[model samples]
Target chain A: MAEIAATASKRDVGRGRGLVAAIAWRSLWRNRRRTWLTAGGIAFGVSLVVFSMAFQAGSYGDMIYNATSFLTGQVQIQRADYIELSRFEQTIGDATETLRRVEQQAGVLSATARVEAFALVSVDERSFGAQVLGVDVERERQVVNFFDRLSRGRVMAGPDETVIGSGLARNLNADLGDEIVVLGSAKRGGVAAMVLDIVGIFDSGISELDRSLLFVPIAAVQNEFGLGDEVHTIVVRTQVDDSRAVVEALGHQLPEGLSVRNWDEVLPEIRQGIDVDRLGGMFMYAIVLMIITFSIVNTFTMTVFERLREFSMLKAVGMRPGKIVLMVQIEALLLWAIGVGIAMGLMVPLLAWLQSSGIYLGEAIVELAKQYYITDRIYPALGPASLLAAPAVMLAATQIAAFASSLRIYWLRAAAGVRAAE
Target chain B: MSSDIVVSCKGVSRTYQEESVPVHALRGVDFEFARGEFVSIAGPSGSGKSTLLNVIGGLDRPDAGTITVDGVELNGLNETELSDLRLHKMGFVFQSYNLIPVLSALENVEFIMQLQGVGPAERAERAMSMLDSLDIVDLADRRPGDMSGGQQQRVAIARSIVTNPVLLLADEPSANLDSATTEDLLQLLRRLNEERGVSILTATHDPIVMSYAQRQVNLRDGAIVEDSAAKVA
Candidate 1:
């Protein structure tokens, strides 16, 4: 009895190993071109995912940095009513103490209080609208390097001095040292107007910001607009690594009238825009992957059909149907592994070039990007997640395709397979 | 009836359903094969020789009646049991030399032993011995496609007897071979039956195959027409 059991186990192991080797050899050599082609399809699908994801990551990183550095700081604190209502009435009466409290918070790196309003700027005949930001030059410099981004003249250093973005300057035909008139309603109501010399021209690499921001000294804005000890918002910066935690902590500690928001909250429209762009990218990738999967399935089905006779012969010699299925599955896995390996091999060089040189679209595409997404050059950056996820996705997709085709082989009747040969 | 009968069939019948039409391939037939017997079932086309062989080999079940091989009643066993019976107690050879083309000659013979749960080292030893007995040991490493039709058939024969089955079934084993190859195969079958004590039942229309059998059963339209023990010296 024991000898029978021992023999049975030994045969099982031998058959298992033989089955694996047979499947591996059949998968590679029987349909050489088709095997390589299927592998190519998987490789292409995986590479697209990896490259596109890396590009999106890089683009989003750029957008976030530009948005935050151009206007809002890493974090912003405002009256709770101001964020919900966005009305002029929600301005804080005493921003000085609030600014002090924010700066004292753990992980708080820098803090500044500012007033903001929307108005029109005109130089001679040309006129354009702009968002007027009131800032303390030194504190504002600590949060955002508006002065460092100047293309013409110096940043505002006095109460009456102002800096205009390059696009805003172009729209209004205003130049450095030229006086531009700003017109809008003051905080109290009636009318408010100011004429200030353009001290600097800044370019933030974002069309929306570059085309419509005018920065001036807070005292000057206060006097011209009758703001009377009120500030619109307080911008804060935290240590980079601890920014999210700092924002969450500050959000819970703020008083009822005040609200703190991260960069994402401050720019909901931009975030939503990015999310839509990401969805579109994902949809495009999915379409490409589906086509690749179909090609692979077709190749595998043909391979199986061609080898029908051989499989029957194996079965006749006591090969189990389940073992046949396992053999085919192992073949698929080998194909996937090879495909992913080739893609990884190709991607390393391609990604390096893309990261260093960037992807150059034609002038027309660049213009379109400027008109819509506000950037001309597309830079792809490698993220760990994007790099590692490509092979996994390919393996899963190929395995599914292989398993679906393997079922036909598994359910094949041994007698029927042999009958054709007879 | 001798108690030494290794195979006994009592009124066995097989009907196949083809496209919703019932085709009676075999009528009720009774037969018996003794241990270590070399037997042949001779018939023309559609005479139920292959069907009868299939039932005895446990590759297919009869629609009615009982088949007992070495005391195990085949009709009483389920599909898995029948598979186990085939794996352990029966081996098959086909006219087409149905050997997996991807496997070498040695691997083909080793397959049955593998299925029987033999270890690799021992399976190789036994398979090599079988190939040596047939004088095809030199072609052990060559795949079936690389060898001649006769060599492939020899491998198939080796595969059949590797597990030392209680019964070996061959269906038209010489139909695709030349006269010389057929004679060589017949000599091997004769030696295996005489020397190894393995029971073999072959279904063939060839007179050359019938000449080697110790007993011959002739079938016509699914019924046995003649049963004779060969007059051997």
Candidate 2:
């Protein structure tokens, strides 16, 4: 029957989303090269952001872990005036009890108490002032990262043995097993002096940490200075993710005179340093995303301009101008999804390899990094946040451009647009 | 359907400012059609044939006149309202089959119903049925690029009536078709008009179209010179 009917055909129907997406899909495939190129730009942009973000976070993680775990433990309990004055008189009296309390606290990984004193060390009649850290042998090993920074003979073996800095040893012209005399003021207002064997030497990449720092057994330093069971500070290592909880618990348990300081509080400068680094990284992310957004705007704008007839034809077929705009936006979003999907696919394996093997920037950086109390190897870290963040930013950015380009549709006359060639 | 005037255009005037010269496309034209009529507006080029169709189909607004389609006034409707009105009540067939190129022929047919809020299964079934009526069901899944000129026009016609619009407006629908295809199209349209009682308004200079139309609207210089009703042989 060759017949047409304008009678209502009644039945429930769905706008097969399959059909619409298929059309969108087909439209993209029509110009596969351009589609790929546009999508490629987004993928490359996202990947760069992801890679850089992961790299920065990884490096910072290493630095923080090393600095807090070794050079300065995550949390430090000190006599309130010890950090400011560094005088032996402002010491924590009976620090062993405080150390025992902190060590038993939940989330506290390890703790060490130290008697820090400034003294004069003389080698071959050449004397130089040095900062000596008197620590318990087993506790010191547990509290600090000695493996990465110890470059010479070994850690201290006896109360009479001392570990000096590479720069200090160089200046003293001292070798392992050589004896040096340490002179300092005893707590009872008397001159105290002792001769110690140099058992080990450490080279921290930072000139300052290596130049004047030395480690000695707590017994020997206490005997030399005549301070009995007195320590300047207690350094505690806390679980990184649990530091807040640990700090809260520590506040309630510690004695009145000993003050607990978290890594952020202990190294506000380093915190600021990290914030600055993050700011720089974020700036780069913003710049890259902006460029990608404009590229999307330009590409979709040209697409809208070129598909004028298609848009108008859609309007003629009873599609609203707003709907036409939506179609364009959806198209851009599809492109974004494609790009971000490709980025995630490639980055997953890439990041895993980087985090495992690590990137060695240079020997100089590796060496210098030890001064900050972090490792020499810098790894890339792609966290869940960055995995979601890069794509989401790209998606939102591309959508903004898609919407902006779609505004042109509102101005297009269906009659004129249906006749446009391109 | 009753003989109510499905479309009524009275004293419709349209003037276009073409770069500086004002061209009067339609000048005080009066026309109307009942619900189940097959009418043609026949004229030479520049006789306001397409212009008259555009105004009646709610595609173009007249400068001075009132047009009522399926009881809705086109004069007061906004762009969106007019678009909705067109989507549900008025369907158009352009001289060049303007099927969305990316859509399959069946999707092109389903386009109007999709816009009219028809569900997928129903629109698909209806679109297939519509294509069957036009003898182009085989071309349903083929995009316009892959279809012949005749098949594309069939798909265009199918798209126009898929929503069961009150008025089907054709502006030279057969302009690009060969004589045989034109005959086939007219015959299919004639069957639709006679059996299903669809009202059709076509603007064309083709003699074959005039032969199929029950009523002929003759326009000269944007005004109706003669309005005549005749029987098809």
Candidate 3:
């Protein structure tokens, strides 16, 4: 009995491997064009998914960075009442103490205080409404790199000097060393106005900021507006490794009249924009996947119909219906693997090149993006998750499509079919 | 010697449904083939010869009656068991030569051994030996499409015999071949039966095929009309 069992097992192993090899090789080589076409369909679908996902991811990353570093810091700490109402009556008095405490917290990389107000700036006859920012130049530069992005002149050099955005400069017909007048209502119901020389013009690649941002020394803006010893907000930069933890900690420790917001929440609209972009990407991917599914199904069905006589011959030779089903499945899987593999091989380098070179949306799309999403540039960034996820999704989709097309072969009765054909 | 019955069929019937009508392809066919016998099932087109072949080969199930091959009842076995019976004990050569176009002659011959669970080394050895026996060893690596009709038919025969099956069923094996190739194939079949003691049951309408057989079972419509043995004495 033991000898019989051993012999049976040996035969099984030998036959199993041989059968698998013969079936896989023959099935792959038999209908070369059909197999390749199915594979190409899967690869095309996967490549579209991978490239689009990578591009969308990169663009989102760029959008957030261009919006935040170019304007808002990673985290913003402000008076609770100031956030809710922005009333001139409520402000953070002695923000230096809070700034010192925030800087000491773990992951808190840098901290600076700023006061912001709506005002109008005029250069010669041209005037535009602007958000005037009162900043500690050294700390602001550390957080935002505003000095390096200056397109024309230097950043604020002293208390009376200011830096206007490039778009604002273009609109106002102003340049470095030009005098601009700032006009607005002060905190105490008194009209406030000041004359400052533009020290530089900076472009943050964000159209909104470029058109309406004016940076001045924090002390000068405070004195000119008659807001004594009060800072409107404290901008903090947290270490990348501990940004979320630091934000949560700061949210707890901040005083009642103050509120803290991470970069994500500070720009809810940007997050919403990203979500919309992701949905658009999903819609496009679904369309492409559907097209690929149809192509694969069509090819497989045609192959099956064309090879009916061959299948009949296999059945006549005593191959089980189940083995026939398995053979068809293996063929489908091979085609899918080949197609997706080729597509991925082609797309990886293509997407990497795109990541480095970026897809130029042309001037019209750039302007449209600026007007719609408040940014001028679109950069593709693929995260690790997006890169890995796109391929998995595509493979799963192809498998389902292939399986659906294999049903006819699986249920085929060799005996009946062959007799009928004969 | 009577104990060596390769196939025994009793009251076997097959009905194929077409559109909404039933076409009886075989009716109460009682047949038997002995071990080492080269038998031919002769019938005109639309007769029951192919149907009888299919039923005996376990490629089709009879609507009624029983078929026993090597004393194993084919009707009682399930689909898998029947498939195993075909894979292990019986080999089939088709009228069309039905060799897989993608596979080379050697691979086509190796396929039955593959189905029978033969290892790569053994399958290669047996397939090459079979092709050599049929005098087509040089064409072993050529695909069916790359070979002539006679060569393809010879490869098909080699594939049928590669697994060392007890019964080799050939359905019009020489239908597509020229007269010379047909004579060559008949000689090969005669040699296999005479030397190897392999039981063969072939279905054909050709008188040439009938002349080579030791026994002929003639079918008309759906029933056997005559069963006659050639006088070898």
Candidate 4:
């Protein structure tokens, strides 16, 4: 029969999705080079964003870990006034008991108590002022990462043995096995003096640290300073990256005069640095996505403009303008999917490799990075946020471009369009 | 508003703005076509033949006057309503065949039914049956670019009439076809009109297309100068 009748079945059965999508998909390949170029632009932009996001995440995590591990640990419990004043008289009185309590808290990986005092170190005729930290040897090894910078000799195993910074050793003209005399004011107005054997020398790479920091046994400091078991701070190593939670949990259990501080509070410089760098990265990414969006807008505008007659013909045969617009949007969706798919195909394996094996910064760059406590190697992170953020933004951008370009269909008069083709 | 009249246009006037000058495409035209009748509007370029078809098909609105298609007034209908009315009641065949280039012949035929939410199995069946009737069933999977102009026009006709519209409007349908292909297309239209009881209104200046019509109305400068039906009656 020449005539075909309309069926009275369900009005919303299929909505011609397959046919419309097929048309939209096939229409992209009509100009193969333009399609490739547009898709390539999307791929390049998305890949750059995704890769950089991963790298930023990985490097920032490494920086935070290193910064905390060096001396601050992930969380710290200190006498309330000690963090600001750093005086020998203001100290945590029952520090050993407080350390034990903090180590019992969930997410507290390890804890060590230390006594910090400013003293004069004299080896024969040479004498210089230095900041000496008296720590529990085994526990300090577990909590602090400064031992990783040890250049000579072993960590102190005797009460009177100490490790001095290389710069301090140079100033005092002291060598390993030399006995150095430490003298400082006592907590109660008497003389605090000690003679310690220098067992190790470390170069921490920071000029300030190398010039004046030293570590001795906590017993020796408590005996000489007349403070029997008092400590200035208890450094905590948290089990996970969420140190604030650990710090909060530890805060409620600590003694009345002690306070717990997370890495962000103890090291605000790192947080501020990350925030500023992230802002800059976001601005750069926005510019990249905006340029890509402009290219997409141009692409769809030309696609729709060139097929004016086809769209008008569609309208003439009873297709709504909304449906025509939807078709164009579907084309945009297909294009984005192609670009994202290609990116994922190439990026997943590469990011996996980078995550497994980090890229090493050379010796010169490592020395420069060490001042900020960053490690020698950097890894690209492979996480859901890094994977999804860029593609999601691109998807939204492309859809907006498609919708903007397709608005011209609303102004299309089917009669004029068809007549113009004639 | 007669039940037998498929379309009615009264005192229709249309004007176009060409740059800074005004051109009257149609001036105070009155015309009507009965159900199941084959009629042709014959005129030269700029004589308003396509303009009359466009206005009657509800693709364009008249600047003055009223048009009623299949008993519904086109005067106040919104774009969406006009689209719905056209989808269910009217079909159009353009001079250039204007088939969606991405779609195959059968897909083009089934597309209208698809838009109407017809079942896939049934629309495909009907599309294939329609193509077979047009004697081009073998070209069903071929795209328009691969088919001859005659074959493409046949597919276009299949697409337009597949939804069983009450009125089929053809604008210069034979303008791109050779003499032999034009004759074949006219015969196909004649068969579809007689067998399916569809009302057809074609706007053309071709003598062959006019000769196949039951009634011919000639236009000059946007006004109807002669009506064969009025003379016959």
Candidate 5:
């Protein structure tokens, strides 16, 4: 019996709430043109917000993926001075052992060691300074995309064998099965010199990488450099999109001379580029939305004044001042919902079309990509945050405007309000 | 009918600040209305008839006197408490803008009941019954804009009485009505007062409204000049 009575009482309260909400919602449609104009402002603001956010997010992903795939891995275990100096003396003494330990880390998918040195290569009276990367033939593929990125012969077959980049081969006038002289100042005692056979050549489409890269077996690099057991860097690939977890996990457990550097640390310039772009996007969003807020305030203030008599009638009819505020906020939310819905409707198709046909960055970007190792085509990605944040900000800003304008209504005296001119 | 007082005022005075002058709308007035009695405050424009009714209805507070409704001091209650009193106990009929423009005739009636937390089924039933009694059941779904002046007044009456309020205050309700409509509205108020035992107060300059009151109070320049009991029609 008590439960039944309680349910009935709750039902009555709910009925009252439903009626209040219905009245508020109906009030929005009373001035259709004003409502549409306000909704249009929100749509314009949020469309820009959504488009910029999605573009920035997608561009960041592409840059990170390309940067990591082409050159850097997710994390790098390197000597403390190797990044800055690149000196042969600053080598990881037990790089193979470090690679084994990193591979066993929780999120680590694969790991490879490399001994890189700036060496002079000569073939048939032509010579060029090339960066020789001594790598494990099988393990290097798991870290970088170089193995599958081949155009000519395969990866280095054995010791004293090398795979030269097409640009470097062209510069040195070298061909497949040609023997090239490579000389480097070894860290131990002597000048390291070798006549290595070029068994393969490759083109990665990145002109910088193709211009000055040569790959040889790590064992050969160790023997030639007179450093039998040391490699300069150990690169690890994590199984996840973010490497922070793996980097933090292994940072504390590494040997005395080694530190774990994630992609951001290894490539701070790329991280800064993404950060600057994100900040620019947010700055644009804030400016547009602040104008939208003022528009809301102006729109609602005019509405509140025009409807003073109506509000006064409602007050006389026993509508609370707080409910009046809620009614205005409901109007704001309704406008936001309509605007965001339209923007999303328009954005989805546009983004899909752009995604299908990747955005061409034009001549400047294409030249920059050729000059550096950057990719030309950017595929913008839309994340869940962009999908959620735009509407959230629009509604919040509009509600604040609505609340600020509705404050004027609470000061409306019922007696004067009833007599106030329409 | 019982003669217990529903509204009482003592030495009620109000001043209005208009530009640079203070206009005394009401001055040291004492008044009382008994339960179920229909009284009309009649005067010319700016004679404080509206101000007196506004004070009695808790829509405006007296600056220098006390107004009491149903044992609750009007000056002592906060805005929210006063709103609750009006929602549950008092009804109003304005001279114009009586109905919310967006609401239908039926919905306007249900709005009061809904605000009072009446069950949906009960609110709809009582609203329909009120519309039926007012002879406007066919216009239940018609919005206020679609209704004629007379028809809208009838709908306003339905809304006012649907809650069964203890006091029904009408301020110049017949101001915009034609003579025939004024006569009809006055008769309807008389019927509601007699049938439902509702205490009625009306502030108006309309002679038609003044004629139907059980008692009439006359005001001039913010002071009551005469009080007399008149025969009910």
Candidate 6:
């Protein structure tokens, strides 16, 4: 023993890792029912968290796509002050050149130039203030598809033709083919006027746009308004999920006065709506995870307290307190791994099924869904963010609870502990 | 300070607080236990025999004075150093047998040697040899929960002496055993003492245990009252 002791003093003590790990592994099964129940609870919580995150991501994606597809076009480029001031004088000078430059950027599916001016429309007895959007008819087709929702006639086919919203058409008590005169102030403070034949009336499902917006060919508006080869904004449709990427890609390349805006910036209420809904969902997930964490803490506390005598015996037999604490931590990690593994096994396929076979909300919400540019079918999207969030939280929380509960061993006196057991 | 003395304690005093009132478990115990000697500390309940055993084994510290085990002072050593000293040089046999429940008998016996960084093959051979000496090699793979009290105590004894410590401390080793089993246990300790010359110090109230010892020290209250060896001299 003295010879062995002398040799041991040279080598590292507490190095018998295999038996310690084995001891830890076997100890977890001492209460098989409790272990399984706790692991099952973790699995249930993780599955719920991952599944709900997938659904949220899927729904948010759909909402953003729907809202941006028709009006915002995912990304837009305009004069630095144009979005805030909406000044007719603040316009991009080379509309065709700007459109060409924006279309050339990567991830840009399509780009269209438009001129916007606030005007008064009059047809005989009725007159109301409206926002007239001057758009390049052919290129606009590739950017926005509101024209597909036209209720009467067709999209503007000539320089003097226009498409008015359904609400505006109803307000003016006007029909397709009726001519209306638009009057506005152009750049240089001159009177800009035009008589456009109402060729189409569209119900965009958005009341704000339907009540106050109109569209006409860019050339006629430019010709009458005396705005030579200039447009207010260039809208770009992107294939990417986030419009900010395209905006960043186009940031340095654009002319100095031009500023790029993502769909969120263009339509802040949609972003705000998604953010508020996401916060509420996160709060719910946090509550679920916190509950699971508390249960884990309780489980570990009971385990350590009940095993104090056994731990004291180990210590008396020459086991370091750190080794014993390490064993408990290993048990926690194993539990976490088992729970998360089962959760992944169950959730991956479940999410795949939900992703492919979307949940249909039925016709009751079709109209209401349409108002927010959402559809009846919502597909749950499984991405990296949703895949990893729950398991990471469980792992971190489990280790913390285990370490906290296992700390009592460090303060336990070996002889007192053994005697207390007696 | 002589090399022949396995344990030395001088003016050792330990006090415990039970509900804020001080209980003097040990008051100024001074003694030297020689190598290869089988000694028993005999006392009634709360007579401080167990406390003296604990202090000498380094399982508990003396609040005043000093304890030196095999020339290493217990007063100056840190917790880890004390643990190492216990692991390498001292062995403990409890009345309850205190074998780790999760470990098989063989693993429990090999546990201390493993902590000493012995190779796996040597640890297994030595553990089996020790169990064989105790006539319990057949119970090697059996867990403590699957064994009777006598069999468990034999395994605990095998674990304690497997690493061949300088001193073995038994605190009421026969307290939970029947008469027949106690005879077998005492014979085994005597045989180990005769054959291998291992020093042992046991604290117990049992007359049978005290009868098996070569020398007996009797205590009352918190101090030693009689020494059989001194009386014999």
lDDT of 3 at A7: 44
In model 6, the runs with Cα more than 4 Å from the true position are: A1-14
Residues B112-191, model 5: lDDT tens digits:
88877787899899999999988899999999999998899899888888988889999898888999989988889999
lDDT per residue, candidate 1, A205-280, as tens digits? 6668889998989988888898877898988876544768888888877777677788878878778988998899
Best by lDDT: 4
Kindly list the per-residue Cα lDDT of model 4 for residues B91-161, writing each as its tens digit.
88999999999999999999888888888999999999999988999999999999999999999999889
Residue A389, model 5, lDDT = 85
Model 2 scores a TM of 0.89
Please state the Cα-based DockQ of model 1 relative to the true two-chain complex. 0.36
How many angstroms is residue B7 displaced in model 5 relative to the true structure, after the best TM-score fit?
Answer: 1.2
Name the weakest run of 10 consecutive residues (lDDT summed) in model 5 chain B: B224-233
User: Which pairs in model 2 have colliding backbones?
Assistant: A13-B119, A13-B120, A14-B119, A14-B120
lDDT of 6 by residue, A1-422 (tens): 34434565675355677677778788889999878888887898899999999999999999999888887799989999887897888889978887888888888999988888899998889999999998887887798876778988898889888999999998999889899989999778889988989999999877788889999898888888878999998989986475678899899899887889999888899999999999999999999999999989998998999899888887787776777899899999988888899999999998899898999989898888888778899999999999999999999999999999999998888888888877
| TM per prediction | 0.84, 0.89, 0.78, 0.94, 0.89, 0.94
CAPRI tier for the interface of model 5 = medium
Residue B131 local lDDT, model 4:
95
Better of 2 and 5 by lDDT: 5
lDDT of 2 at A264: 85
**Candidate 5 residues A126-184, lDDT tens each?**
99999989899888888878777778887777898999899999998889989999988
Assess each prediction's global lDDT (C-alpha) against the native: 0.80, 0.81, 0.79, 0.89, 0.83, 0.88
Best by TM-score: 4
Best of the two (4, 6) by DockQ:
4
lDDT at residue A60 of model 3 (Cα atoms): 73
Expressed as tens digits, the lDDT of each residue in A1-422 for candidate 2 is: 00111222121123334556666667777778888988998999999999988888887888777777766778888878877877788888877787888899988888998888889998888899999889886886687775357788888878888988999999999989899999999988898888999988898666787889889999888888988888888888876667778878888887776678888898887788889989988998999888888888888888877787777777666667776676677788899989998998898899999889998778777656765545767888778876778889988888888888879788776766643431
All candidates in order of lDDT, best leading? 4, 6, 5, 2, 1, 3
In terms of DockQ, which candidate is strongest?
4
lDDT of 3 at B198: 86
Q: Tell me the number of clashing residue pairs for each predicted model.
A: 1, 4, 5, 0, 1, 0
Restricting to chain A, the TM-score for each candidate equals 0.79, 0.85, 0.75, 0.92, 0.84, 0.94
lDDT of 3 at A349: 76
